[model samples]
Target: MSTAVRRRRALTGRGAGALLAGLLLVIAANLLAAPILLYVALLLFLLVLFAVLVVHIPRRSGPVTRRISTDLLTVGEESQVAVRFDLRALRIPHGIWHDQLPPAVSGDATGEFPTDNGTSIRYAITGVRRGVWAVGPLTLHTIDPFGFAQRQQEFGETRTVTVVPEVVPLAPLSSNIGAAGGTAHTSSTRLGQGSDNLSPRFYVSGDSMRRIHWRATAHRGDLMVRQEEEESSPDALVVLDRTARRWERQGPTADVAFETAVSACASVALHLVQEGYGVDVLDSAGTVLGRLRGHEDDRDGLLVALAMVRPQGEARDIVSLFDGTPPGPLVLITGHLDEEDAALLRHGGASAPILLMTDPLPGAAEAAARLGWSSAPLRDDIGAAWEDALPARMATGGGHVQR
Candidate 1:
């Protein structure tokens, strides 16, 4: 867009060839005493001057309307766009065009087409990384057929592309949670007379005629009454560490480790949601970024939230993340496994925390080993790893309470 750049592009490839021809003309004229050589040099100089003018002249491209298949996408999925340019009654010859693309996107952003036959430009966009990115306004560099000059023009407006994290079914925790014919983390209590789909409930007094279970009353010969509501603890609580420092290997830039951490969290969160659990994604400061309440909640909403999460570069208070929650299974996802970070898992109010990391954590592992807590590597292939690790750790019996 700068004047300097426009001036540079104006130097067409054919202009150089023409200049060469002019030089040869002058040489022959000098040797043969030909007067045409002077005219040839003049012509070459005039042509070069014309190129300069062509670059400096303001050129506006035909009005264009932009169309993208979608503005929202999953990390591994691809989206595409088509731009329609009105070329009717237009004087544009052949032009090279380029659309601005985000760094996380993979594919060619440039294209070339003659305006004589068509008015559309199309490109496919795939996101290899997760995050919020800016996708475009278009820029054009057009070349004249004579090669004497070029024209530069830019049009359209920048658009945002939100790329959410990839989600896969999480490895099931080795417990009765999966056996409940639903996702509740623990074995359901006795089904109460009320609330739909009872997961084992407790019997209470003051039972109404409609509230009492007739089948249970007949079996026990007493008024079998229960609250239809299920206990909340049997549900899983997933904690994510968004501290800026923990995910960073360098300054604010997060490496693949952080990405892995996010993917791990997303996979686990999606799994829990499917199995019927609620997930609250938070930062190190306990700042609530988003939540997904099992199958009852919007699945894409959670992924969209996860897609926008970025490393905060602060030390997240991992240990106390579940300080006041009704106890159940606690799953924490982070990059490196460290003692302080692991402490959140060790001391969390739950019976024992299930610590999952982007990769293997020796310090955390040793801590988990000694404390009898369930801990394991969280990887790109998280479902398989979780499926493999959960049972062994549970069978070994996650350590006894220290508090």
Candidate 2:
């Protein structure tokens, strides 16, 4: 409101013809000694001055409120964006109010709104891209009774809408081999399937001896036991390569490769979270963007983070990303593979690490294969390389998405 008040300024535009005509008439009438013409010209001049004065004062308008169908929206989906004006009994007979909006929400009418009981206007807006955008600061276009002057006033605060990435269905990385009780499930599983579902608590004095987790006791140097939490999701770590290195043969931005890569990341995160998995999303820099599990809040946050992530540089630090990650199936997504990357994954402790390449590298896939990494190449039909990375049964029509 204060910003609007400070910005308010009087603009005398578009009524010059009549002002010129009145000035000419006054001079001509004075030369011709016509009192009636002279009187009319003087009256017209005075009226114009009065209108300008009226338009300049009280520059600030009333408060405005905006509402969207939902604050959380998906890319390519349409939502109604509406704004309401709290017109508190101002005698604005012929004025139009316009709200400034982003191009994504353009095409809505920003004209005169009703003032009798307050007015609201709505537009159907579809988010073209994923990211957060602000919508706000209402502007009022007020016209005087004579239609000769229009005054502008601004009101209201900024509102934000988050457009999250589209979550497409993707088959689990491995069906018969990993994560869930399967062939890939090792005997010495450090992270238990039960702990993901059950909450572990500090051991109390009366706890049963068998219930005490010796492993937790060894790790924590104190007795610990599992406690029941209504529901929890399994943990899954997704490593994304953000290095500006070559994914597709493109410039610095690498728009095409980045788009496909982001889609792949989003797909993986969404699939894991929806299917009762806590996903730790990390970039090449080992920056943990989101640790989203099946929880409602985690799911929402993961999608939004995926939508805005882009390649920062080459994701050369593989070992750094492994730090603090709970034992889980690892999915490494990268533009290309190197010897160092392959060596790191070989002994990384992930029984069968899944590798998704954004593009088909000449020898990178083979290098990873030699080290026993499941390699999947990027394809047009496949939204992400992970689709092809899965076993045949889980990759296509017969696969189960869980949720």
Candidate 3:
């Protein structure tokens, strides 16, 4: 919850009129030499001054508190805001309450201040964009009984509302892709399957004697044990290239292209998780942004992280990320991409990476195609791009799928 102190002081219509009349009467009295007019003017001046003092006096009130309807608010989502304040006594006869709202949120947060103690106001707010927005310091518009003077008082600390990036549902990976288990249940290779199919290898120091293969050990003149492979869920990487210079920004709101990329990253991560894949979100520079294992809480955490993610970093190579190991399935979402950048990504390992560019530079598409990468433009409808990448993914067998 947020509040503020006195913000401004000014004269009301009645106060301005009285002061002007008082001055006029004083001038008239001097011109006509009338003592009666002078006395009336003095009384009028006193009345105006008294009204100002009356409005400026302190009023008894308790601390203000605010509440938001939901813990999670996404961009373009609406939520209710309720503010409560204790007005023990009213020093001024009339006043209005206005809750201050930041530009990141939109709503009407104003009402008449109650004459009695304990007052509350409720209004609706729509998150205009993603970010942590300050809801307000409640402002009170106070006026004197005669409506001669007015003052505005702000109260309480501002409350923060976190608006996360919008997460859209994306299409599951095609079955032919043979990469993710989203479309089908993957089989586990744990020992219980069948001993006949299990292969034996030279026993290591850590091998248990109970698992030693006597038949293989006799033939090779060395101890051997059945190879043990545990069934594990598939995993994928969603990389967002947040190069600041690549995206164009509009005042207040984030860059449209960058926002689209963020949404795509979130959607892809969540979709892969739902499809039974352990997902890791990363930036183009190979920094891990978030990791999800198909948990309810983890999904929310990922969205929150992306909500505050900003475009950063200069040109950096991503080849180091997959230097010696293959990234099972990689999804790269970025703003602009040039031919050089596309060629640089080719050495990042053969996970049959999917490249989504908001603005693909000239010759970049040709370079991506030549490198056998599935490429598509990231747009408002993420499903379209997902669909476009499906054929390429299926043709290349997307990524290595553990059997």
Return the top candidate by lDDT: 3
Candidate 2 whole-model C-alpha lDDT, 0 to 1? 0.64
* lDDT of every model, 2 decimals: 0.63, 0.64, 0.76
Model 1 Cα lDDT, one tens digit per residue, 64-159: 677778666777788887877664334555678777776677767688855563468888888877778766666777665567877666676677
Better of 1 and 2 by TM-score: 1
**True-structure Cα RMSD, model 1:** 8.7
- For model 3, residues 1-403, the per-residue Cα lDDT tens digits are 2333444648987889998999999999999999899999999888888888887766655788999997778888999998888766555478898898777678888888877677788999988778777877888888887888998877777899998888887666665555446424332233443335567899889888999989999999998998755545455677888877777754655688888888889988888787776777878777777888667788888888888888877646655554455555678788878888777676366454788889989988678878767788887888777766654444655642222
lDDT of 2 by residue, 297-384 (tens): 7777777777677666655456556654433566777765565555555425555467787665477767776665666776543444
Q: Distance from true position, residue 310, model 1, in Å?
A: 3.0
Q: What TM-score, computed on C-alpha atoms, does each candidate reach?
A: 0.74, 0.72, 0.80
Clashes of each: 15, 5, 11
Q: Sort all candidates by lDDT, best to worst.
A: 3, 2, 1
